[model samples]
Target: MRPNRVSLVMSWLAMLLMGLAGLFGACGVSAASAAEAPIELRQGTVTTTVDGVTRTEPVELSYHWDRQHNGRPGTASFDLPFTLEAEPETPWGIFIPRVGNVFEVQLNDALLQTYGDMKRNNDADYAKAPIYVPVPGKLLRKGDNLLQIRLHADTARLAGLSQVVVGPAASVRNELFESANAWRFTGSVLLMAFSLIVGGIALALWLTQLDVDANGMPRRVAIYFWAALAEFFWAVRMADGLVAEPPLSWGPWGVLMAACYAGWAAASMMFVYHLAGWANERRHRWVRWPVAGVVVGTVLFSALSLQRDEPAWFTAWLAVELVFVAAFVGAFALATLRHPNDDRLLMAGAALVTVAFAARDWLVVRLSDAYGETTWVRYSSVFFGAVLLLIVLRRFRAAAVQARGSVAALAERVAQRERELAATYAELEAAAQVQARTHERERILREMHDGVGSHISSAIRQLQSGQSSSGDLLRTLRDSLDQLKLQIDSIHLPPGDVGALLAAARYRLEPRLASSGIEFEWAVDEVEPVEGLDAHGMRQLQFLLFESISNVLRHAEATVLRFEAGMKGKTVQLRVIDNGKGFDTTRVMPRSLAERSGAIGARLTVESRPGRTVVQLEFD
Candidate 1:
C-alpha cells in the first residue's frame, strides 16, 4: 500500500511538470516570433550629396524637410542595414510607412522601386500609408544588406517620411497592416461608412417629416436635415484619410477637404441652433449673418489658397474650424444648462466629445509638427451623429403622439359644433311657426273687416232708416252670412295654389248666386300650379272675387254669373262676367281695390255697360 501511494504521488508530480514545460515552450516560441519581427527604423541619418558636398544629420520618423530644415528642392538619401537569418535567395521586402513627394528605393546600389516623378508628376503626393516594395532574392545579400532610399521633396507642404521596416514579405505585410496608423485609418473608414448610412436614414426621416405650422411656415425638420448634411460632409472629409492615393491632385484635394470641413461646421451650427429653438428667436437673425460669413470666408479662403499656393491658408482654415467647434460646444453647453433636458444633455455631451477629440488632433499636429491622422475625431463624430439621430427620432415620436391627440381633439370639437348648430336650427323653426300663426290671425281679421263687417253695417243702416223692405233686409243678412262663410272657407285653402283658391270661392259663392235668381257658371280649366300665392294673398284674392260676385247679385241685378279661371301664357286670367244691369265701371270701381290688386302681382279692371259687366284679374 505504501508503494502504491508513492507511485500515485510520483504520477501527479510528473503530470504537473509536463504542464509547466508545455506552458514555457509556448511562451518561448511567442517571444522568438516577437524578437524576429520586422525592424522599424524610427531614427535615421539623412545624407544629401549636392555639388560634390555631402551633408549628414540625425533624423527621426516623420521628419519634415520643409523650408526651415532643407530649403532647396534637392534629393536626400538614407541608408540602413538589414540582417536576415536565412540564406541569400530568401524573399525579403522593404515597407515604407509614409513618404512625401517622390522617392526611390535601392538595394546594394541596384534600382528596386521608384515612387512619383519630380518633373512630370510634381503634384502627385502619397497618402500617409504604407507602401510595400518587394526585394528580389538575388539582389538581397545574407547579412548586413544595405537598403538605401533617395527622397526628392519639391513642396514645403507636409513633406516627410514615417518609419520603414525591412523583413520577410509576410512579416513586413503583417506589420504594415497592424500599424497604429493603419488601425486608425481602418477605424475612420468604418466610421465613415456608418455615418453615411445613418445620414441617409436621418435625411429620409427629415424629408418625410416635412410639415407646415399654422402660420404656413415649415416646422422644425431643418434640424434633422442639417444634422444629416453635417454627418455626410464629415464622412466625405474622412474618406480622404482612408485612401493611400487621393483621387484629386494634392492642392485640389486640400481645397475640397477644407470645403467639406466648412460645410460640416455650417450645418452643425444650423442644426444646433435649430435644435435649441434659437432659430425662432429674433436674435437668430443677427447670429445667422456671422455664421454665414464664416462659412463663406472659409470657402473663399480655401479657393484663394489653392490659386496662390499658400500653405498659411490651411493653418487659418484650421483655426477657423477650431473656433467653430468651440462656439458650437459653448452654445450646446449653455442650452443644456438652461433647459436641462435629456436631449440637450446628450447634445452637450456629444459636442464636448467632438471638441475634445478635435483639440487633441490639433494639439498633436501643432506640437509634434506631424500630421497624426489617426485622431479620435472621426469616432467622436460618429458618436455625435448617433446622438443626433436619437434626438430626431424622439422628436418624430413626440410629434406622432401630438398628432394623434390633435385628431382626437378636433373630432370632439366638430361633434360639439354640430350639436350647437342643430339646437339653433330647432329654435329657429319654432320661431318661424309662431310668426306664421301671427300672420294668419292678422289675415283673418282683415277679411272680416272688409267683407262681413261692411255687409252687416249696410244691413243695419237700411233697417234703422226704414228704407229697406223685409225681403231686402233678409237678403242682405243672408249675403253677409254667405260672405262670412266664404272668407272662412278661403282660410282653409292650401297655400300657393290659385286653382284651389278659385275652386273654394266657387263652392261658397254658388249657393248665394243661385238664391239670388242667378245662374252660376264655373269654367276653371286645368292650369299649371301657380307660385308665390301665400295664405294671406289667397284670402285677399278670394275676398276680391266674392265682393265682385256680391256686387253683381246685390246691385247689378245679374241674371247669369260666370266665373272663369285659366292660364294665358305665363299669366293667370280670372274673369267674373255677369249679365245684369251694369253700372258705369269708371265710377263704381274703387281706387283702393285697384291698388290692392296691383300689390298682389295682379291687374284688376271692371267693364260695365248696360246689361254686361266683367271684372277681370290677371296674375303673373
Candidate 2:
C-alpha cells in the first residue's frame, strides 16, 4: 500500500474517534472513586519547625477526586468524620493507597509530598495493601489542623483521599483496588478488540482494491492485520481477569504482540519509502535495525519474566520501546520535511498515531489508574483506524495521477510516430516523380538509336550494294542521315564543362549567323567547376538553345545577336539577345507555347523590348 493510503485510513479513524467519544463516557464508574474523592475539605492546624523553634499556624484542607469519576466520594483507612490537630514537634501521618500510581499529600492543607512511593505493603500480588507516608514535622503547626491528599487511582486503588489524623487505621472496604483492576482489563480488552476489527476491515478492502501481487500489498498489510488480531485475543483474555494465572501466559500471544508491533513499525516505514519514490534495497537496513533490536529485547525480557516484579526490567523495556518510537518519529519528520507533495498524507497519518499512542501509553505508565478509568485507550484505537482510512484514499489519488502522466506520454509518442510516417510518404511521392521522368528519357534515347541510327546504317548498306555507282537518291539519304546523327549526338552526349560546351556551340553557330547575314557577339566567363547535369536536363537545355537561335536566324532578319553564359553563384545563367522585328509579348503566346512543347518552329521568348528580344535560362 502507498503511504498516502495509510495516511488516509488513519485520518479517517481519528475523525471517527472524535465522533464516538460519547460512547466511552457510558462505560462504568470512574476508577478514581475509591481513594481521593473520600477526603472532605476541612480546617487544619500546623506547626513550623524553623531554627529549632516551633511556631503554630492555622491551615486548611481540601481535595477533588478526578473529575471523570462523577464526583463519587471514597473511604479512607481512617474514619474521617472527626478532626484532630498536631504541632511541629508531632505531625499527623496519613496512609493512602493507589500508590505505584499517583498521589499528592499535604499537612494542615500545606503541600508536602508531590509524588510518593507505593506502600511496600503488598506481597508481590500488589493486591494486598494501601499506600502509607509519614508527614514531616516542619510542615505542621500547633493548632487546629487541615490535611489534604489528591490521589490518581491505579490498579491498587480507585479512590483518592486526604485527612487530618494521627493514628494507624484500616478501612473495612477493600473493593476499590479490585474495581480499578477490573476496569482496566475491560477497557483494554474493548479497545484491543475494536482495533482488531478495524484492522481486519482494512485488510479485506486492501485485498479487493489493491493489486497485491504487483504492488506488494498482501505482505505489507497482512502482517499488521494478523498482529492486531493476536493482540485483540490477548486483550480478551486479560479482560476475563484470570486471578489464578498470568495474563498472556499461554499460547503465542506475547510473541504475536511483539511481532505485530514490529510489523507495524516496518510497514509504516516501507509505506513512506515507496510512496515518495525513494524505494531501494538499502532503505530496509535503516528500517530493520531498530525492529531487530526490539525482537532481541522482547526475547530477553520474556526470559526475565520469572522475575517480573523488578521495576528495572519493566523500565528498561519501556525505555527501549520509547527509543524505537523516537526513531520512527524522526524518520517521519524527515520524510515530511523533504517531500511534502509526495509524503504529506503519510506524515499526517504517522503524526496522528504518534500523538494518540503516546498519550495512551503515558497514562498507562505514569497514571495507569487514571487511564484505566478514562476512555483514552478506545480513543487512541479509533484515531488510528481513521488515520489508516485517510492513507487509503490518498493512495488512490496518487495512483490516478501517475496513470494520467503515463497516458499523456504514450499519446505524445504516437503523435510523433504519425508525423514520421507522413514525412516518409511525401519522400516516396517525390521519388516516384523522378522515376517517371527517367522512364520518359529512356524511351527517347531508344527511339533515336532504333529509328535514326538504323536508317543511317541502311543507307550505307544500300550504297555499298549499288556496285559503287550511287545515284543521287542514295547519296542524299546518306547526307541527311549524317545531319540527323550529328543532331542526335548533341542530345546523346554526356554533360561537359559549361564553359567549353558554350564555347563550342558559339563557334558552330557563327557560320549559321554569317549565312543569315547576322553578326554574332559572344561573351562567356571562365566558369568554375560544377556538378554535371543529367541526360534529360542536357537535352532540354540544348533544345531550348537550338529553337532560340533558329527563331533569330529565320524570322528576325536581324543584323546582330549577342550570346552570354556564365556561373552566377550556384546557378548557370544564359541569355540570348537579338536585334529583330520583335513581336508583342502578349501576341507571342502560341509561339512560346510551341517552343516549350518542342514543336518544329516555336521557341521560348524573353520579354520583348522596342528593338531586341532576349531569352534567358537559369540552372541550379
Candidate 3:
C-alpha cells in the first residue's frame, strides 16, 4: 500500500482499538465481597525528627498527615493502633490508598512490606496508586495489632497517608483493584494511547500536505505540523502518569516532562491562532513572538529546575502553560464568534472543554495536594484530537471536490479546442484545392506560350521577312502542330520515371525524324528510377530532347541520329548525337534552352565540329 494509505489504515485501527478500550474500561464487573471482615483504621500518630529536632503528631487515617505538620519536609513514621477479634489462619493484609515518597509497613514491629528505598531520591514513588501489604497470620495477635509506616518526603509536597484499610487478602485485593481502576489510571492510559494515535495521524497528514514554495513551507502547514509535534510530546509526558515509577531519573524525567508540557502549550497556541486565520493578517503576526518567548522561557526554567533541584522553576513553567491555555481558549472562542463556521465552532468547543478540565484538575491538585488525582485533563485531549481529525478530513474533502471540478473543466477545454482544430483543418483543405487549380491553369498557359504561340510567332516573322514560300510556311505550320502534339503527349507520361518520359519523347519525335530522311536510334538502359522528376521537370527534359532532334533533322544535314538515356550513379543522363555537318556549338545553342535546363537542375551541353554534333542533358 502507499504510505498515506498505510498511515490512514493504521490510524483508523488505532482509533478502533481506543474505542474498544474505552467501552470495556467503562464497564465494571462486580466481584464477590471479600470472604473476611474489613476494618477502616481512622486513627494514627505520626512522629518524626527534622534538623535534629523531634516532633510528634496525632493524625487521622482519612487526612493527609503532611498538612497536619504545616507542610514541612521530613522523614516520619506513622504508628496506628488496631485490634483483631481473632488470629485467623487465613491471610490478613493492609491497604493504603496513597503514600508519599518511600514507606514500609510493619506489623507489630515486624517488617511486613517495604516500598521504595528511603535513601534514594525517588520522589515519583509517592505518586503510586495504592499499596497492599499482606500481614502474616502468625504475626497477628489474638487481641491488639500494631501497624507502623515509615515515610520520607520532600519540601512543599504532600507526605504521609490517606485512608488506610485492614482486612483479609481477598478484601485487600478488591480494594487494590478499586483503587487501580480510579480515573487516574484508566483515563491516563486512554489519553496517552489516543494522543499517540492521533499524533501519528496528524503528522502523517501534515507530511502529505506539505507544500514547498520559494518562501519555504506555508505558514498554515507549519502550524499544523507543530500541532502534531505538540500532541506527540503530550503523549510522551502523559506516559509518566500511566506508570507507577519514573522511567528515568527524577531530574531528567522532570525536565523532559516540563519541556513536553511547555512545548504542547506553545504549539497548541500557534495551531489555534493560525487555524483561526488570524496569522495571515500583518497585525496579528507580532503575537507569535511573545508566545514563542514564553515557550523558550519555560524550557529554560525546566532546565534550571532540573539543575538546581528547585520546584519553583517547574511551578513557574506550569503557570506559563496555564496562561497559554487561557490565551488559546480565548482566541478560539473569539474566532468562533467572528466566523461562526462549523470548523471554528468545533475547535472552540474542543479548546473550551480542554481548558475546563485543566482548570478542574488544577483546582483538585491544589486543594487535594495530590498529583495522581488530576486525570480529567488528559481525557480532555481526546476531544482536541478529534477536532483536528475533523479539520483534516474536511480539507481532504474540499480538495477532492476541487480536483473533480478541475478535471471537468480541462475536459471541456479539450473538446472546445478539438472543434476549433477541425474548423481550421477544413479551411486549409479548401485553400489547398484553390491553389492547386490556379497552379494547373498557369501550367496550361505556359505550355501554350512555349509550344503553339512560339511556333506561330516564328511563322509570322518568317512570312513578314519573306524568307520562305507558302509550301515552306505550310511545312513549318505542320511541324508546329507536330510539336504541339508532342507537348500534349509528354504531359501524359508517368511522373518521376525518366525511362517512360524518354519513350514518350521518342514516340513523338520518331515519325517526324523518319519523314526527314533520318534514321532514329533510341537506346534506353534499365536503371533505378530517379525521384522528384515531376511532370514539369519531365516536360522540360522532353522539350530539350525534342528540340535537339528537330534541330539536327532540319539543319544538321545528317542522316543518322541517336538518342540514349541511361543512369550514371544517382543522376539521369540523356544524349542525342548526329553524324552531320555540324556548326559551332557556341553559336548554335539557344539561350532559352540553357535557361530552362538550369531551372530544372539539369546540365545541357552541345559539342559540334566537322561531321559530328552532340547534345547532352544530365539531371539529378
Predicted structure with the largest TM-score when compared to the true one: 1
Tens-digit lDDT track of model 3 for 1-620: 69999999999999999999877765522111222467778788878866567778887765453444444456788888887656655787787777776777888999987777787664556544566777776887767888888887654344567767788877676656465656556667777888788788778777776444457755336655866887888898778766656777665666677678767767777878777877768878987887787667777876775565455555656666677668768877976897798888888888888888877765665345443343576767878878877776686577568768977999999999999999999999999999988997888788878777887888998799997888667757766887787778876877767788777767777777787789988787975565767788878777777677767766888999987888888888888899999987666667777887886788888788977888888877
Off by over 4 Å in 3: 1-35, 40-81, 88-96, 100-141, 146-162, 175-179, 209-227, 243-248, 366-372, 402-410, 413-620
The 10 consecutive residues of candidate 2 with the worst lDDT sum are 120-129
Candidate 2 lDDT over 1-620, as tens digits, reads 69999999999999899767755543322322222122333444433232244445454432222322322222221112333332323233554433222445656556666553333211122221343455665554434554544333321122333333333222212344334444554455565566566556546545654334555554443333433343344334333322322244322343444444444544554544454444445655566566556656765653353233233343457566666666666666666676675335545565556655655564554344332223343345445445554565566566558768877998999999989988998898899889988986775666556445565676677677775445443533543443354355565455645565566567566775675578989887776533555554454455556557766765676899998878778666778888888877775643543444343222343666667887876555
Total backbone collisions for each predicted model? 0, 50, 0
Compose the digit string of candidate 1's lDDT tens values, residues 463-488.
99998998888888887888788777
Give the top-scoring candidate (lDDT): 1
Error of 1 at 390 (Å): 2.6
Winner of 1 and 2 under TM-score: 1
Question: Using TM-score as the measure, what is the rank order of every candidate, best first?
Answer: 1, 3, 2
Candidate 2: RMSD to truth = 26.3
lDDT of 3: 0.73
Residue 32 miss distance in model 2 (angstroms): 25
The number of clashing residue pairs in model 3 is 0
lDDT values, one for every candidate:
0.74, 0.50, 0.73
